[model samples]
Target: MRTDHMLSMIDDFNGAGFEQVDLMAPIQFDVSVRYLKEDPWERVRQISRRLPNSKVRALIRSRNLAAFDFLPHDVIDAWVDRLVANGVKVIGAFDGLNDIDNISRALVRAKEHGVETFGAVSFCESPVHTDELFVAKAQELIEKADVDAIMLKDAGGLLTPDRIRTLVPALKSVMGDRVLEVHTHSLTGLAPLVCLEAVELGADAIHLSVAPLSSGNGQPSTQSVVRDLRALGYVVNVDDERVDAISNRIREIAEEEGKPLGEPVEYNGLHYMHQTPGGMLSNFKSQLETAGLSDRYDELLHEVARVRKELAYPIMITPFAQFVGTQAVMNVMAGERYKVVPNEIKKYVLGYYGTLLAEIEPELREKIIANGASDIRLEPSEPAPMLPSLQERYPDEDLDTWLLRAQFAGSQVDEMKKTVAEGGNADEIPQPYFGLIKALYEKSEDGQQHLKFGDLAISLDKSK
Candidate 1:
C-alpha cells in the first residue's frame, strides 16, 4: 500500500445494524503501509478489528514496491507476528518476487504464522482477460502452495465480462470455497455488472471502493456492487446511512487536499469500472494533462509489450509507463536511455524502432490478433495462472522456506518507521502514481497529520 493509503471510510459502520447484512466473513480492504509495521495500534490499524473482525481483507502494495525484490524473511516474519497478534487472519500481497517458488514459500510462512496467504501476478503473457489459466494457478496455490484462499487481481483493469462468465465457474470447480475473492476493474464499464455475473457464476467476494473516489481507473465500485448484490439476493451488509456519512467525511477530506473529483459523475452501470482507488484523492487523467499523448497511451502500451517480447525475460511494464505511457515504450526499445515527446514516442513505436516480430508477444499479442482485436482494453479481474516452476532453476529449494516482508494494502511504513528518509526517488513521483495517493491521505485530520512527514515532497513528473 502507499504511505497515504488508509482504510475504507467505514468507521461509521461500527454499530449494531451490521448484523443485518449477510455478506461472507472475508471482505476486501485498503490499508496504509504505516499501520502494518510501524504503528499497529494506530486508529487506521483498528479498521480490520471493526470489520466485524470477521471476513474482510485487502490487497497490499506500495507505490514503488513493483521495483522491490521479495521481502526480507525477517520483515515477513515480523508482519505475520503482528497480524496474528492483532487477531488478523488471511493475509495477501504481491510484488517482490524472483519466481513462483518464492511466492509459494511466502504463503507457507503465512500459514505457519497462523494466517492464510494469497498472491497475485498478471497473466503478463497475454492481455486478453480470462480465467482459463488463473483457475489452474489458483488450484495449484491451494494444494501446492498451502494457501487457504486465492484472490485474482486485474491490477491494470484489463478484463472482459465474457471472460469472467467463462472463467469464474472454472475457478470455482477447482479452488471451491478456497478461491474466495475476485479483484477486478472498470476499464471496460463492466465492473458492477461483471461482478454480479461473477458472483452468480461462483466468485465468493470482490474488491470495491464505496464511493466514486477514484472510480474510473481503479477497481469496481463497492457501494454499487453491494446494492446490486442485495437486489440479486446475495447478502451484502452495508448501512446506507452509514455509507452516506462515510462518503461525506471522505468529501471533507478531498476538499482539504485540493483534489478534483474528475468531471461530475452520472451514475450508470459502467460507473464501477471507472473507480479510482488511487483517485480517492485525484485522477490519473489530470496527471496526463501535459503528456498530450493521452490520446495515444493505450496504443503505446501495446507497443511497449511488443518490445519486451524481443527482450524475452518476463519483463514488466514499469510504473514509469503508467505516467508517460508513450515515452516508456521508446525507453524500453531504445535499449539505452533516450528522450522524446509523448506523441513522438507513440508515433515512433508504431512507425519505427521495434523488432515487430519479437515485440508482439506470441502469448499476448497472438491472442489479441486471434480475437481480431486491434486495440487493447484493460480490466482488473485476474484468476491465478496455474503454472508451476515452468523454468525452475533449482527445484530443490524448499517451496516453504524463504524470506518475505509484510506490507499490508494501503499501509505506509517508511515515515512511520524509526528512520527519517529523503531522496529524489521519493520525489518526481508519477501522478496517477503517488500524486493521487498523497492527496487522499490529506483528507481527514488523522490522515493529514499521519502523512505529515516534514519535507517529504513528491515532485510529479510534469502533469500528463
Candidate 2:
C-alpha cells in the first residue's frame, strides 16, 4: 500500500468502530526503490503509534529479504527486528519459487522477534504450478518452517473458481486444521469469485479492501464480500454501517483529489500473458511516456511475455517483476532483445537469488552468458552480511534509522527527517480544491468556467 492509503485506511478503520484491522504492508525494498525515494517506515511508525489495536503485517520476499540481491542472515535478522520494533506484528513470507530454504531462514528470524509468520505459496500458472505442489508447499511451511498460518498469495489473480474449488480443499487437507488465508488481486477479474470459492471451501480469512479502494487491480470489496458471505448463510463479523461510511468518505476523497476510483476492469488476455501487477503496469506506462515511447505501450506488453518466458517464468512479483519489465522496456526501445541485460537478470540466471523453478532454455541461457552475464563469485554457502557496513556508515543512529539509510539513499533519509521535523504529515493534507478551481478559471479564455452536471449546465465568472 502507498503511505497515504495506509494512513487513510487506518483512520477509516478507527472511525468505523473497528477495534482491529489487518494491514498488508508493502515490502520495504519495494517501497524504498519503487514507491518512495525516502524511508517508507516513517509513516508506518506513525500509524503504529496511533492505532494500537490494529495489526500491521509486511510482505517479505523470503530469499531477497526485501531487496533485489540476496541478503545475509544478519541483514535479514536486522530487517525483521526493525520491522517488529516499528509496527509489524506479522510477516507474510514467501519465495517466488516455492523454495523452502528461501523462506525458512526468514521465518525463523521472525519467530525469534516474536512476530507471527504466514508462510505463503505464490500462486502462478504453469506445468509446475499444481494443486499438489501447493499442498506440499503448505505442509512444508507448517512442518518445517513452523509458520503460524498459510496464505495462498495469488499475486497475479490467476486463481479461477474451478481451480480454487480444487486447490482450497487440497490445501486444507494438508493443513489439517491450520489457519488458511486467501490473498488475491483483481487483475484478471476473477478474484471476487475465487475468494468466495475459497471461503466456501473453508478458508479461515480473506484479504479485502474497502470499496473505491477495492476492485480494479486491488483486492475484492470487503463489504461486498461480507454481503455475499452472509447471503450464503455464513456469519460475518464486520459492521455494515461503518463499512458504508468508510466507502463514502473514500469516494469523496478520490473525487476531491481527481484520483481514479476502483472499478472493475474487463478481463484482458494481455494481463494473463505478462502477469504484471497493476502498480507495475502503471509504472511501466509512466516510464514509457517519459521516454516518448508511449505509442509502443502495447508492443512493450507483448515483449514482457517473451522476456519472462526466456528468463524462465519468474513469478511476476517484486524485484523479478521490475527486472523483467525493465528488460522488456529496454528490448522494445532498443529494438533488439537481450541487447542490454540488467545486472539483476544476470545474477538471477547465475542462481544468486535462489534456483529457478523451471530451467531457462539452454539456448537462451547460453545467449545471456555470451552477452556478458557471468556467475558472481560470492560464497556458495550463504548471502554476505550487509549490516557491518551499514553500522559503519550510520554509527550514531538507531537500528530503525540505520536500516532506512542502508536501504534508501542518504538524501532521502535527510528529506524524510526534515519533513518529520517540520511537523508535516503529507498524507493528512487535504487536496487543494480551490487551487484546482482557480486553474480551471485561468484556463478559460472568457474568464468564465463552464461546468456540466448531466444535462444541467452552470457557469462561474471571475468577476462574480
Candidate 3:
C-alpha cells in the first residue's frame, strides 16, 4: 500500500473503534523491504506513529526474524527492541512448527521491553493437532514465556464451529487469567461462525477486518460480526457509523482502483483435503501455468496431500506450506517423487526447523536424505553469533542497516539502498513487476536472465 493509503486505512481503523490495530509482520519479513525498499523499521515506525490511541500489535515468526532461517540471538533481541522502539505495544509470536522453544525467547524479549505479548497457538487440523495438544502447547507458552494472552491463530482457516466449541474451552482451561483471542481466516467460509462460537465459549476477543479487506481469505467483516454479536445480545460497543464510513471508503477505493472486493466463499471440502492457503493455492495455479502444466493442477494438489502426509502433517502453514507446495510441484512436474528436494525440505525433515509433531516415514526420510543437498548436515546446528561479524564487515552502518543487510543478500540490499537514494516510489506506489523479478532471479541458476512482459523487457545480469 502507498503511504497515504496505509495511513488513511489506519486512521479509519482507529476512528472505527477498533481497540487494537495489528500491523501484520512488516518487520519480521522481506515483503516490506522488497516492495517498499526503505528501512522497514521506518515503515513500521510510521504505521505505529499513526495509532496513538490504539494498541499497536505486530506478529513475529520467532527465530526466522527477517529471513527464512533461524537468526542469531543478538538479531532476535535487536528485532524485538526495534519493534518496541518503533511504538509497537503488543507482540504476538508464532512458529510454523508450533515449537514453543522457537518463540519463547522472542516473547520473553518483548515482555522485557515492557510490551504486552501474545503466544500464538497455531491452529490446524490433523489427528496429531488434537484439542489436548493445543491446550498443552498453550500451557507451555504460559509456563515458559508468560505471555499476556494466547492467540488461537487458525492461519489455515481449518477450524470449524464444532472444532472451536471443543478447542476454545480446552484452551481457556489452561489460559487461567490470560486473555484468549480467536484469530482465524475466512478461507473455509466458517470463520465468522467460529468467532461467534469462540466468544460464547469464553474467548476474550476475536480478530476482524473491515469490509473490502475482509471475508475472503482475510478475517471476518467487522460490520457483519458486530451486527451478529449485537443481535445475539452481546453489548458490541463500537461506533457503527464510523465502521460503515470506513467500509464505504474502502469500497470506493476498490472500485476506483478496479480491485476485487472480498466476497463470501462457499464451503469447499477440497480445502480440507489439501489445506493449502488461499494465497498459496493461487500461487500454485500460477506456478502451474508458468510451468505449462496447468492441466495437472488437481494432480499437484493431491501431491501436496501425499507429500504432507509423508512428512508428518506439518500444520500446512507457511515455511512448511511453501516447502510442501514446492516439493509437490516438483514431484508432479518431474514425474518422479523425491527425485528433487529443496534445501528447506531437507532441513525440515532433519528437524532443523523444530521437533516434528510426528515421525516422517522411514523410507521417505531415507529418500529425502539421499536426494537432498549433500552439504546439509544430518543434525541441525546452533546459529553462531552474527552481529559481531556483521558489525566488523560494515563498521559505519547503523544497526538498522546492518540488520537488513544481514537478512538479505548484499546485492539486494544495494538495490534497495539505490531505490531509496533515487527517491523511487518504493512506498508511494505498488510495483507488481518487482515480485516477478524476485521470483525469476531466484529461479536463475546462472547470474543472467531476460524477461519480457508485453512490450516492456529487461535483461538482468547478477554477474555484473
Candidate 4:
C-alpha cells in the first residue's frame, strides 16, 4: 500500500468505530517507498499514534526481508527492530518458495519482540505448489518458526472454491487450533468466493479492503464480504453505516484524484494462464502506454506467459513479477525473446536470490550466461553500520529522515520533506468547496444564497 492511502484508510476505518484493522506496511524494497515524498516510517509512526486501536502489519519476504536478495541476520534484526519500535503489531513473513529456512529467523525475531508473527504461504499454481506442499510449509511455520498465526496469501487471486475446499481443510488439520487468516486479491473475481470457502473451512480472519479501494487490483470489498458472511449465518462485527461512510469518503477522494474506483471485473479466462496480480497488470499497461506500445498489450501478456514458463514458473509476486514483466516488455519491443535480459533476471537464473521451483531450460540458461550473465556473489552488509553514511549525508535530519534517505534517493526524500512542510499530511482529508457551500446553505433561513468574489460569482439553492 502507498503511505498516504494507507494512512487515510486507517483514519477512515477508525472514525467509523472499527476497533481494529491490520494495515499492510510498505515492504522494504517497495518501489513506491522510493517515490513517496515523506518518510514512510514517520507516516507509520503517526498512524500508530493516531489510531491506538488498530494493528499495523508488514509483509516480510522471509530471508529477503523486503529486498530482492537474501539479507544477513543482522540486517533482518535491524529491519524487525525498526518495525517493532515504530509500533507494528504483526509481521506476516513468507518466502516465495515456501522455504521454511528463509522464514524462520524473521518469525522468531517477531515473536521475541512480542509482535504477532504470521507465517504466510505465498499461493501460486504449479506442480511444486501442491496442497501437500502448502500444508507442510504451514506445519514448519508452526513447529519451527513458532509463529502466532498462519496466513494463506493468494497474491494473484489464483485460489478457487474447488481448490479451497480441500486446501483449507488440509491446512486446518495440520494447524490444530492455530489462528488462520486468508489474504487474496480480487483479480480473478474469485476472491470473494475463495474467502467464503476459506472461512467455511475454518479461516479465522479474512483480509479485505473497503469499497472504492477494494475489488479491481485490491482486496474484495469489506462490505461485500461481511454481507456474504452474515448471510451465511456468520457474525460480522462491523457496522454497515460506518462501512458506507468510509466507502463514500474513499469514493470522493478517488473522484477528486482521477483514480480508478474499485469495481467487480468480468471473469477473464486468460487470468488463469497469466495469474498476474491486478496492480502489476495496471502497471504493465501504464508502462506500455507510456512507450506507445499500448496496442501490443495482448501480445505482451502472451509474452509474459511464455517468459514465466522459460524461467520455470516463479511465483508472480514482486521482484519475480517485475523481472518477468520487464523482460516481456523488452521482448515485445525488441521483437525477439531474450534479445535483452535484465540483470535481475540473470541473477535470478544464477540462484543468487534463492532456488527456483523449477530449473530454467539448459539451452535458455546457456543463452543468458553467454549474453554476459555471470553469477554475482552477494556481500553480507549490516544495516546498522550504514547509519554512519546516512548521518553524514543527512546531517540535520532525525533517524527517520536518515532512514528514508538510506532507502531512497536524496531528491525523493527532500521532496517528501517539502510536501510535509507544505501542510500535505497524507492523513488530512481535503475539505471540498461543496461542503462549505452546504454549510452556508444550512445556516441560511431562506435555503438560498448568492455570493461574489471580485470577478467570480456563485449561487446556491438548497431546495434544488
Candidate 5:
C-alpha cells in the first residue's frame, strides 16, 4: 500500500471505533523499505501520533523479529524497545515453527515495557497439530511469557467450524482471565463460520479487516462479521456508519489503483494438504508456466505435501514455505529428490532454525546433510552476539539504523535512503480537495494551478 493509504486506513479504523490495528512487520521492513524504498518506522511514528483512541499493534516474527534468521539477544531487546518508542502499544510474537522458546523472550520484553503482548500459537493442520497440542502450546506461552493475551494465529486458514468448536474451548480453559483472540485467514472459505464458532466457544476477540482487503486469504470482513454478531444478539460496540464509510473508501481506492478486491472462495480440500497461501499459489502457477511445467502443478502440490511430511511438517508459512516450495520445485525439475538440497533445507534439518515439530527421518536427514552446505555445522548452536561488532563497524549509526542494517542485505538501506532523498515516494494529498487539485495540476499545460475549497485555498507552481 502507498504510505498515504496506510495512514488513511489507520484514521478510518479509529473513526470506525476499532480499538486495535496490525502493522505487518515483515511486509513493512522487507516490502515497504527494501522494495518500495519507504521508511516504515517513520510511518509507525506518524500512525502512533494520529491514533488517539486506537492501539498500534505490531507483529514480531519470534527470535527472527522481522528477519529470517534468529537475531541475537541484544538485537531483540533493541527491537522491542524501538517498537515501544515508535508508538507500538501491542506486540504479537510468533515463530513460524510455533516454537514458544523462540518467541518467549520478545514477549517478555514487550510485557516489561508495559506494552500489551499477545503470545501467538502459529496454527496449522497436520497429524501432529491437534486440539491438545494447541492447548499445550497456549499454556506454555502463558507460563513462559506472561503475555496479556494468547492469539490462535491460523495463518494457513485451515480452521473449520468443527475444529473451532473444540479448539477454542480447549484454549480458553487454560487462559484464565487473559484474552484468547482468533486470527485466521479466509483461504479455506470457512473462516467466517470459524470466527463465529470461536466467539460462541468463549474466544474473547476476533481479528478482522474491512472489505476489499478482507476475505480471499485475508481476514473475515469487519462489516459482515459485525452485522452477523449483532444479529446473533451480541452487543457489538462500534460505529457502523463509520465502518461503512471506510469500506466505501477502501473499495474506491482499490478501483482507483486497479487492485484486485477480496472475494469469497469455494472450500478446497486440497488446500488442507499443501497449505500454501493464496498469494504464493499464484506465484507458483506463474513460475511453473515460465518453466513450461504448468501441466505438473498437481504433481508439484503433491510433492509439497510429501516434502512437508518428510521434513516433519514445518508449518507451511514463510521461510519454511519458501524452503519447501523451492526444494519441491527443484526435486520436480531435477527428476530426483534430495539430489539437490538448498542450504536452508540443510540448516532446517540440522535444527538451526529451532526444534522441529517432529524429527525428520534418519536416512533423509543424513542425505540432506551430505548434499547441503558444508559450512553449516552438523550440530546447530545458538547464534552469537553481533551488536558490538555491528556498532564497531558503523559507529555513527543509531540503534534503529543498526537494526535495519543487521536484517537487510548489502546496499538495500542505502538505496532506500537515496530514493527518499530523491522524493521517489508517493506524494501526500492529505484531503479529497487536495487530490482534486493534484489531478488538475497534472492536467495543466504548464504544471500550475490554483484552487479554493470553501475557506481553504491552494496554489501549485511546478514550473518554478
Candidate 6:
C-alpha cells in the first residue's frame, strides 16, 4: 500500500483562505485518524498513493494501542521507518497514562529514523490522580521531546468550548510550532464550538469524525462540527457523499454485533456534559427530557448557564453534569461547591473507570460494586474563617504535620485499598492505620465517607 502523505492538492478549498476561521471545517488542516476510517490496508494503500495530498493519520488510542500489553516497539520502529521512507510522516500521540511511555519512546525512535513525528497528549482528568505529576510530565515532554506537534484529544467529549479557547492558547504558548491538532468529542454539544474556538486561536489541525464510525459507543460525532464550520464558510475538504455510506456501514456493524448505536446526534439541548460521567449523563439527559425542556432547550441552556455562573463551587468537581471536558476544565470546575480532600491523589477517583481493574479481577469488582463511593463538597456560608473540621479536631496540628502522617500512612493505606478490592476487615488491617482513617473521616462530610482502603461502610469514626 502507498505510504506517502498526500499533501499537494488543496483542491476546491484553494480558492481563498479566509481571515475568520471556523474550525467546524478546518481549512487549516486535513481530516485524518485511522481509528475512524479503518479502510482495509489495500484501500488505505490506494488512498495513500492516490491522495498523497490528503494526509492520513493513525490514532494510537485504545484500538491501535491496547492496554499496557506489550506492543512491538521494534515493529513500530520498522513500520514508521518504512512509512517515512515511502514519504508518509506519522502523527501519533498518547491517550492513556498507560500508553504514554510507549508512544513517547516511539516518538524518539521515529525522529531518529528521520521521520517527522507529531505527538499529542489525549487530555483527561485521570492522571491528576498523580496530583499534577502528569501535567508536569507533559510540560517536560514539550520542553525536551522535540516532537513535531502536540494533539489534544477529547475522547469522551468532556471538554467545553470555554475550555478549548483557554487550553488551545495555553498549549500553543508551551509547544508553539509543535502544537499540531485539536480533536474533540461532539459529546459535550460543544465539540464544534470548541473547534471554532481552537481554530480561532491558530491551532494547526482540527480532527473531525468522518460520519460512519462516529457517535456510537461512547464517542461524539464530528458531523456537527463539519456542518457548523461549513455554515461559517470554512472550506473543509470532507467528501460529504461518503458520510452516509460510512455511517450506515457502522450502524450495520453495531446491529450485527448486538450493541446499541450508543450516542446519537440530538439537539435535545442538554450539554454534552451529560455523557461525561458514564451512565450519569444518559440518565440526566432523560431527566431533562422528562422535565419537558425539549422545546425550551434554549431556555434550559440559559438557566444552566446562569446556574453555572451563580452556583457556589466545591474544591473538586462533585459527580455533576456541568463539569464536563478534559483536565483543563478543572480550574473552573473546582470553583463549584466540592471540597477537595487533603489527600488529592488518594481521594479523587470518582470518574475512574475501574472497569479493567474490575474485569480480569473479580475480587476487585466485588469490592467496588459493594463499598459504594464518596462525593465532593464545598464551603459554608458561615461568617468566620472557620478552620476545617480536621484543623479543629487537633488544634495546633499543622496541615503539614497532618500531611506528614498521611505520608507515613500512605504505604499502609495500600492495605485499605486491598480490603476494598479483596475484602479485609478493619481489625485484620494494622491498628495505627485505622487511627488515621478514623481521624480523616471525623473531619470530612457525609459524602466523603468511605475510605475504601480503610473500610467502605465504616461510619465517620471508622465504625461500620
lDDT comparing candidate 4 with the true structure: 0.75
Number of clashing pairs per prediction, in order:
53, 0, 0, 1, 0, 26
**TM-score for each candidate, following the candidate numbering:** 0.57, 0.84, 0.89, 0.84, 0.92, 0.44
Q: Give candidate 5 regions above 4 Å deviation.
A: 426-464
lDDT for predicted candidate 1 compared with the true structure = 0.45
Instruction: Write one digit per residue (lDDT tens) for candidate 1, span 1-464.
Output: 22233344445655413422211111121122223232333332455565662443433432122222223444444444544555555666543111344356556666787666676644332332235556655655676567766666665444557767776777778765565566665654656676788788877667766564535655665567777888888766666787677667566555544555422223343222221133321323443345554564444444545443332322132332232333334454443423333422332223222112124334543333333223322321222221133115325422221111123322133343332223223423422444465566545454332333356543322222
Question: Please, what are the lDDT tens digits per residue for candidate 3 over residues 57-93?
Answer: 9888868865778888888888788789878899989
Q: Give me the runs in candidate 4 sitting further than 4 Å from their true place.
A: 1-12, 15-20, 27-36, 63-72, 286-295, 373-385, 391-397, 425-464
| lDDT at 99, model 2 | 81
- Candidate 3 lDDT at 217 equals 88
RMSD of each: 12.7, 6.1, 8.6, 5.0, 4.3, 22.2
Comparing 5 and 6 on lDDT, the stronger one: 5
lDDT of 5 by residue, 21-107 (tens): 787576677886777787778778888888878888998887775576778888888889999999999998888888899889888
Top model by TM-score, which number? Answer: 5
lDDT of 2 at 161: 92
- Candidate 2, residues 1-464: lDDT per residue as tens digits? 34554565565576554433554344644454344443566666777776775577786777565457766777667777777877888887888867877878778778888877889988887667788888888988888778888999998888889899999889888877678999998888888889998998899889898898888888998888888999999977677876887788788667665789898777766677888888888888998999999898889899998888878788888778888998999898888788777877777787877778788888877666566444544334575676778788778877776665555554767666665665443443323433456578778887898765444455789787
Q: Could you give candidate 4's per-residue lDDT for residues 1-464 as a string of tens digits?
A: 34555555565566654534664444533443554444567665767777775676777775654456555565566677887898888887777666677778878888998988889888898777899988988998899888878899888888889999989888989887788889998887888999998898888888898887888778998989899999999977787886787788778666655678889987666987887766688888998899898998888898888898888888888768888888888899888778787888877777766667777889998777666344443322333455667678668877655544544544776766776676553443334544565568789998899975444467988788
How well is each residue in 1-464 modelled by candidate 6, as lDDT tens digits? 01111112222112222111111111011111111111122233443454344354543431123221223443344444544444344546453432354466666766787655566555543323231433454565665457777767565565666666666666666665565577665554556666777787888777655444455333345566667778878877665545544455556444433456645554433443222433543544455577554454343344443333222111112222333222212222344322222222112233221111111234432332333233422211212222344367557754432322222223333343343345333333333444576567668765366445533444453343
Shift of residue 3 alpha carbon in model 3, Å: 2.8
Q: Could you arrange the candidates by lDDT from highest to lowest?
A: 5, 3, 2, 4, 1, 6
Query: Looking at candidate 4, what is the lDDT of residue 420?
Result: 66
What TM-score, to 2 decimals, does candidate 1 have? 0.57
Name the better of 3 and 5 by TM-score.
Answer: 5
